[model samples]
Target: MLTETYQQPLLDSIRVIDHPEAVRRFFGLLKELIDIVNLPNGDARLVFSPSRREKGVISADINFFQALRIQRPPHRRTGRGEVEYHLTVKKSCQERLASIEELVFEPITEKSDYVAVIIGQSNAHLLTHITLRSCWEDCLLELVESNKRGPHSARHNSDVYRAAEDEALLSDLIRLADDPTLAERGQNGTTVEEPEADYETESASAQQPHNLILFGPPGTGKTFALQPYLQDGNASLITFHPSYSYEEFVEGIRPEVLGNQITYRIRKGIFHKACMSAIQLAGYGTLADCLNDTPENRHRRLRKAPAHYLLIDEVNRANVASVFGDLITLLEADKRLGAENELWLTLPYSQERFGVPMNLFVVGTMNTTDRSIALLDIALRRRFSFREMVPDPGVLPIIDGIDLPQLLRTINERIEYLLDRDHQIGHAYLTNVTNQADLCDTFRDRIIPLLQEYFFNDWSKIQLVLGDNPSWGKDPEQRLIWVRKKYTASATTRLFGEIPESVDEIVTYEINPHLHRSEYDQLPVETFIRIYQKPTL
Candidate 1:
């Protein structure tokens, strides 16, 4: 008995076979012809007419029209014949061919010879030049049921009973294909396999258009990581800051001197220029050029165009609300140049129609230490995907017995524990240290000052990170006290024991907040070395 697995291939075989015997095998069995319907993609459907002798007409959906040859081989006593034909079905469409499993053929004797008659109805027609012969009755009846409640019980339950499992799997595939979360994931960004500092070429998996923001602590190589994509000559680079605005980004009316008189004229900003360039590269046309646009020409131009990238450094530094203005909606994938929901607007100043090109992809870098991402615009945040680029101490090269990577990780771990991840120092801070002196200078100048800013002059937190105790007198036997003399009395003999008579009553107090910047500066370089000295393998 033919099951789904066997019947599917048989249908595929019949669809591609052009042999006359293969044709006669089925056609000879049919008592009448119905009609042939042509499909949109150059496939055809054959319909068999229902007769009084047959309960239902059989039909097969096929792609046999593209077959190059149609000839029947020698028929055997067993009634199976081999035939060859052209045309190939794409692997993507193989499941669609399984519709043939619905067909059933009944054996009928005519003039002492047996013929097979199709005994089922289907939305799908029959494949041309392919038929079920007398010897193939078992193969055909396998598709039919026996013992009809009425006389025609053979057709009962013969209609394809679609497996619930296959239907469920297909439903799941359709749901996944249309999932809104999947689109959000695409908007957010591709996964990073390496440290953000290591700028590899954009991979094939990363080709889709998305607004990606690489954000992390300072010196995590957010800016440096964009280099590889920019190498393609399709990139436009810009730096966003607190002062950057819509006038500097999209378009604005700028004052220009025409000879002696000053006049204002509409001018394109950096983003506007980039968008225009992207549109040109994307083969989007002006109303005039579209008049002559043909499918062949458009396809040719589309093949030649490359994706354009807009790299924004320090993106979070600029006020997104002021910089994006009305253009923010255009950043969505659906609103890009060639998308279904593509949008265009007339420039307020120039009155020119403009739209963002589909080819233009936006990549931005954000320094988390400089600004809190929580403060970023919700609208902008929704439009762009954010991937955090944390410092990878492993990428830091060791220098002067200082395992910089391990040390940076240790310091960041402490900072993350004490304060938060945003306050953690990046490995880039320590990467410049080549010798002990450079390391010391880095600690005194960059690292210490930054820690001071992070801790707000609270030396206790800094001391904790350095594995030092701010309460030095905890070891009472070995103590060093710093004092500030506020006033002097007239009668004192000695400084420690008794005051001199000439010294007017003096009062001294130990300064609790004496852990100054100078104290941090004077801290021995060995102190840092000792703090992180537990060797990391």
Candidate 2:
């Protein structure tokens, strides 16, 4: 015995060079190292440590490593007590717990920024040669215990949780990740089995842009219309606005207030955070995990899975020259992550130390009505694919899951009659209906008011659309009618003053540029004179 043999097995369990399995097995406990270490069919170094020794913890030392141990079931041995295998941890795991140390025999006492150590046995070693320093230890226990049957399988998280023993499950995943064969496939590690799969991966060498431009008049639902694309797991949304500062979006010194003691921490904004997360998850093969994976594990995404969207709502509102800055590079089909070209320049927000990874698509939306997109910078316009989303009546019917034929017809007619089919609103606003009550509230809150704004009148025309009232007209009488519909009958007198509702009505009118002599025949001479009196009358 190496004097520390009893304890050595425990420490060794966590010290796999890269193979989590070998370390687990060396420490004789039970027979679950294969599962906990997650070995499938490959070779990996299993680093080991018997226990923690806190002589002094160094910061930023290249030789540093973190430790995690897996214990086996107790049993009798042939000539000695009992012996089992101990799985070795990985360099990456240890690197995660920089500035922290693991101690054994005694629980870590003072909390002066100490790392979690699988106490039984463990030790740290420097690896400055490879520039791979700062090993961290994030236990996969919660992960594997929660997910035992593997992914894309129907194994309920509860099933894994209800089990009395789950340490083996995590151990299994870790071991499997070290497998060469599984890495060949997209299952164990971030690498793909076939080189051909890179086309679909987000971190792959080849990924093209999937940009889209949303354009239409205000309130036509361009913003809501792109929600699905914006949050589509694989997609990350980056807004372009005049006041949207680089400091706010990338990295900035945010004021940190500790009572009266205030200081600034290098706080990263949403875009930077999303980029870091994308870098972390760039290797995951599946879209779901790639989109919603945890912080550390998210880095598993292997393909670039062209970030689905980069919704730029009201893109025209932004000063195009300043907003995009150098981001235009990612928009190019030739550009990809890890490219050596200057086109894909790294931001100050992410030095190698900042930990932000590259690989995202930019989809900007511009409302032509806000400003002539024609005025947009020629440099930017050429780089992006300008796809317009003009108003279309065909896009407004959302009768999913319920019999709303009558309601649909009425609403459609109102939207079309007053707002015109080209200006009709998008139906995406109503996709959230869970039941009947929800349906009605949405109609009242969203549809009814929008229609009223178009007709520039009260309830009668709206009632005509809803089949609520009989008399429907394009005359002034209908304008007040629509307004009254918004309020109760008693409040009608209160709206638009005490005048008759008919007086407050808005008569429909349209300007005619070309008219023949007969068009004015019905008008009196005084009416003709009135029309012609624009000459400083």
Candidate 3:
């Protein structure tokens, strides 16, 4: 959730403002600042650029040279109700100048240690923890002279920023610990059963790393969402797909050539990495952390390191046996490292425990559109709750241009017509198509090709949704191609006014080709790109 964005300060400023409807103007200005700088932290100084027009040219005015002083609460929620803080700006009209609260420290040259203007004001205002460059101490002399408020004022040098971070973390922990639906009525549900068990890092739920499932199809934003959970704790991500053998997912014998000698190395596959990560996180150090780099000896130092998650991308592609290997016992929710649960498989190398560690969550994603995925074992299917990651119709209305509200209704009607007869195109595919190109081009090339892949038996489905009567071909495959090509042409014409004369005329390109495309093979790629997109152990 840590965004590499310059809008942090502007957004933070917006959050400090409590009024509801009035915040709209503030939000617009904040977004304007974001677009102007484009830089992560808005490195541009508070320059007095009054001469520039506010059209396409972007710039900031000097607000800091003058100062404004006021007082506010330690923690105020944004309109969305998240805890935050803002600057206390008070400008006396008679004085003809604005003054700000005293800054915590000052700014300097180091990028890592300091970001002037925004960061300087942030430390002085919200956090007060002043992460500063080496020159901050010397540069702060200016603030001391101008600041109307005293250096040690309760508002200045406050620990409110650190306190806010801690508060947010605790709040999230509380939300995760109690299954909100299971809370007893009349009870202060926020009041935890064990106040000491604040961090789920040591909780029973965190051990069941297998309880989760990565729900998005390829490029459905699944990995992007999973990264926060991975970075939040000691976690590992294992991607599963057809041809991802047990040898690749679990432990396997890796052949080594030593001169004339043939050596067998017990190479740890993705599962080995996941387990080792889990064990190290459970309190046990990693094999590399404690022992030598030889993979054969890694099994020697295996212990609990309290893992938090084991994300399995496209899990349905691989056999459950290969994916889980010998770690079934650690994955069950009831079974934990210390606490006992229903007897099942014994861990091969760790302490006596059945089921994944209580803190370990197994999150996997599956694409139901893949007919071959029907090969998924019923037993594994029964264990996981499969929530479809289809694009919500609500999102379509939010998309700008082309009468999306009307387009959405048409999409639903077509989808309903398809689903009523056993055909169901995923919403994720639609969203992906919609996201391609600009507002004009999206309706033209991007969505049409994808819509062709909708897999509907009813020809009318295309006819109703596609606006004009689709020039569906006589054959099914031909019809699908016709749809793709027609839509591509329409979208292109809408975007660029007409199809390009040559490759150079094309305005834009896309990187994520639909996974449904079969032309991409013979190269060992998915394992690295979509699979290992997650950080390693």
Candidate 4:
């Protein structure tokens, strides 16, 4: 085990290595350095130690395989037995730590002034190769640099080889590791805040809302609206359901089975991956990228920040309170990737600091009929801008036999009157009707079943929306219906001393809607076929 006495003295002798022997020494010392820093858990939890003071730590873990383990019952594990006294230990030592997939490394022939000894376990529980020199520094620098030709200079890389010239250089090294912003700031200087009007103009020109929900009644093309963006690789799609949780969407400790043994691992969820990808695509090489006013550079940076869209289908299906977790604050427009109010989070499972990027846009689709938007979590609703995607009958191609748009509008208007706008049918249902048979089939199958569910099996209310001719009464709202049925008459009693044998008879009577009669079943289909029949030119 590495001890306090040998740690600080070793940091003074740290050097960039090119030779294989020197690389071996680097890894040997790296293992000891990791032990001394108390990073066995794959996260740095100590800011100040016997060997170091206020050193910033960046914990990056890589995985090459996948596995599954129990998710419901969280397991307990042991940690360093001593009472830890460290400012960076935000969580207690006894807290369950995430078991992440072991990183796989191979040797690369490249040289650089610095190396990032990314420490991780392999699937076989063996130490993978130390990514030496060029590869190593690239890995380390990627945490800060947005692209090649970033802020790092030869002098900055050589500083780690020699003893600290001053306390300030040590502070700079820590910042370079932990805070990318600080490194960028040191290279490009500070950023001047832009006027609110200019910021608003830039935002409007982007045409991408940080968070948006596209919603309306069913079949309003809410999901279809995402196709153009998805085709361009600008959008990612995910659906939320009742079973989704913060652990699945954000981050959490999940169990994994590796070679007949159970192990826990911290896994990155879909949202986290999207945010990281957006940050990389934003082309934010330095603070200058944000503050530079040169027309060509500004335009290049803005264009380089390709908007990433996260389309959430059925956004309301999941428990919003549980799924969003701490992400609620980070989803704000100003808190986006390159926004002025950008925010970062120290993930609970991996203890890694992460933030949402501005270029990543969240687009969600919801069917208001299934669940009312008004009942949604106020916090989630406030974070997203809502766009109404009601039925647009005018966009449909003119069908040969049917006045499709008019029919849809009439049905929706009736539905709106009977129930509410939320339950109205969308125009897409009738947009493809080309003949009487097509119209009949649509009404009989898709349209009626949906209406039945919406109205709780009330066919009469459905008929009113379809504008079917009344069969039993003048008023469409009337619930009573006349029906015909076959029954055996049982009159064996004598009225005036005479008796009669029982006989079969057919009867008709007015029955209440509670019985839910099916006598008018064929009427709606026939009526729709007649209305949709082609007219002579």
Candidate 5:
């Protein structure tokens, strides 16, 4: 009967509600309710009763709504007594609500009699909250099914539910609460998550630790791996170079001109801004709320927020210890703002106490070719969880009878043998090869140039990697690197007009000139095939 009378209207109201403001207010109210009730297991049945003294339990009555600035009229009876108007949870739903570790309330409208219970887990930390209408048995069943299949799949099938701006607003709250710097900025603060980027469906498994480094050589898709996290516009990308400093990565004093006077002020850097964004996304209304809240409360609240990323491209280029400074300790999972052993540091310029937010993930792309993982700062090594991204030849397709996978495998094998695993050529170099021309261009323009740099202009090693060595017994025309040899006596005579009897024979190597030709006609598909091909016995 309640479903027939109020279900459709409630669903419609939820669809059109000012989700951002509603979510903000909902969390604020939820916080107050939790604080007032102090439910031991973080579960409670809130009864909005008219009587201030309701025996044993605390009545979430007029004062509760008034505290949150929610205006409600006096009780009006239908068929039941004045008790029928009080907000009540169904008997069947009570067990289900009690089972949920953390209960987040989503307010549909100021005038709505029912409060929607959004069930979420602390571990998965999904951004989309599955809104379960109060007293609706069908909605509760759907919530259980959705939780089993995951939020996105549940959202996909549900007709009555919409993630909408409520998700973003929840994210904004979480981030604000997690980062004190953003809390210090107050309501007027600007965050990286604002001006929402295009939405993307992120999986529960994609939620990684607070600090992760994707380390590998060039073209290994280290930076590309971060696309899923960035699509939601909660990510900020910054490239680290030799010149990158603690001041630039964190906070620094910068010059500003006002009127005719040049004055300096402390400016928050990308990391600082990203932290603020992450904190704001976590759901605290103010800095005091973030700072004063217990770790358990913050962690529970953060579970509702989406994960934010600080993408550091070329992470190894900057001095890790110098760039991260004292805040490097906060990068650890246990030392983040809401962790068990939370830590904080006073920034050099701002002097504001700062800690990395639990939801702010630091995803860094480290080019091993630039700086090996072994050489990374000990402090950095201790903080971040490193995942090595190596060349996966299986991802390459065979193009025009050329096995691109084998080609990449062979190149990487030779590179590994000549140098180390870190210098291996990535499969991405040949991923786009569709035909003979593409292969030829790849070898000539990209592969050969990279090998030259890898070997530091030592063409002989390049020749070996390309299967151009004399020992391989390949045809001169077919070789990617052309070799030239001359007797020392003849070479001396050519250069100085005299032959030296003691001089040894001379050898030289060059990249096949035809590869530089506009058409790339000289280097056929066979040239690339031979690099990976073995001579028949």
Candidate 6:
């Protein structure tokens, strides 16, 4: 056993590893290992001790490796003085281990003592290697059986080793060990299964909150990306604007006319209604099944319920802090109903205790042009996983000798330079353009009006974005934004027989009317191509 004096130094040495996330995960994994392998007589201090020969390296004791024990040399120091953790694997496991780049097996001696070590550059590389190693479960079971047959077998007979028997615990430890985010979740005393690749068929075992926010510029397919999760009848969509309030999101009071007299009644809002639907789908008898039951009992009663989704569009338009209220904390995966840190709140309107169910997933969309993610409420940002939906020009096809992809890309690049990436145009605007007529109509209706708003009708900047230069003397019909310079000095003299000295030449801009006129059919393909092409010197 390490003395109290030595323990602090060992922790200090581990803390100097440079990556805070990796350090956190190391401590979490250490606690789990101690719980699993350190018997009543066994000391957990043996798991990590100061190295006698190496200055920076902490000698991770071999006893801690009972579940996945290898030969004596548990760790080796590189020339740079960094420690590399390794384990000895059986021949069968070695063949399966070859596919993993992080786990490499090499000969340590003249005999068959080959050890595998993680050489990846990631901070949690060592921890990830141990959990993801091949045949780990088999080795763990073998260790348990071996301990039963040992000389001091009575020490291993207690419930201390009972956790090793749980398949769910073993699977979760292996699956979640690599994620740094899981370390944060460990603080709340809960473990969640990894989310499935297909959300529609997501497993009921996953305890992580499925809160996702898709954000990007307008017309970037933020809403379209949510289609897959909405195929079933379990999904509902709602839009938020500046006037959106918590009263409409959660439970609130509403005025109802009863026999010519106004009466105020408690009404369930969209979020409250969604929670009720999710609880019912999870096989609960009533809302009381969640509010009154303990977390453990709720966990046992939870069935393989169908997932319920609430899609919030234009999420950033409303004041999220005021809208979510105290329920924001309940949105965390570990704070959901039946979770380890389960929380409940009494509604002010109905006075009913309510909790967010794990089966309910919240997905939101934000238009970054309207609101940048940096300005979002910190509480809301922490609760949701954000996925960016930037424009992809490659998805646009060529139309009638015009490179629609390049045209869109060029315009966005200029827009990004003039304003910011959040104001750039999305490729979806050109996805439907199949011919010159379709392209003309798109620019006349959607593209031109969008640019006008984006640049605040600054004709010169808009002209530059549309590939027009005032000095080039380009044909007026060829330009998307036709510029007409009006000498205010001369205009004022003609109107009132007096010229104001303050009035100088002013440039007026308008979208070419010919784009929508009958002459559009006669317009050449060069009109669109020139938007992306370089001008001749």
Each prediction's whole-model lDDT (CA): 0.50, 0.39, 0.38, 0.49, 0.59, 0.62
Per-residue CA lDDT of candidate 1, range 120-231, in tens?
1121134341332212322222222222222221221111111111233222222323343532454312211123234333463156547889999887888889998675
lDDT of 5 by residue, 66-99 (tens): 1121212123222211111122233345455564
Ranking by lDDT: 6, 5, 1, 4, 2, 3
TM-score pick, better of 1 and 6:
6
* TM-score, per-candidate, Cα-based: 0.51, 0.42, 0.42, 0.52, 0.62, 0.60
- Tell me the spans in candidate 3 whose CA falls farther than 4 Å from its real position: 1-209, 214-221, 286-307, 325-330, 342-355, 371-375, 396-401, 419-440, 443-446, 456-461, 470-537
lDDT of 2 by residue, 93-131 (tens): 445434444222212234312233332222322211122
* Residue 490's lDDT in candidate 2: 44
lDDT of 4 by residue, 259-307 (tens): 3466576766778756644543443422233333344544444444656
Q: Rank all candidate structures by their TM-score, best first, as comma-separated numbers.
A: 5, 6, 4, 1, 2, 3
For model 5, the local distance difference test gives 0.59
Which portions of model 4 show Cα errors greater than 4 Å? 1-205, 283-304, 397-400, 469-526, 529-537
Error of 5 at 43 (Å): 34
* Best model per TM-score: 5
Candidate 5 versus truth, CA RMSD in Å, comes to: 18.5
Return the number of clashes found in candidate 1. Answer: 28
Candidate 5 local lDDT, residue 277: 59
For lDDT, the strongest prediction is 6
All-Cα superposition RMSD per candidate: 25.9, 17.5, 20.7, 17.4, 18.5, 21.9
Query: Which sections of candidate 1 miss by over 4 Å?
Result: 1-209, 283-304, 470-525, 533-537
Worst ten-residue run, lDDT, model 6? 153-162
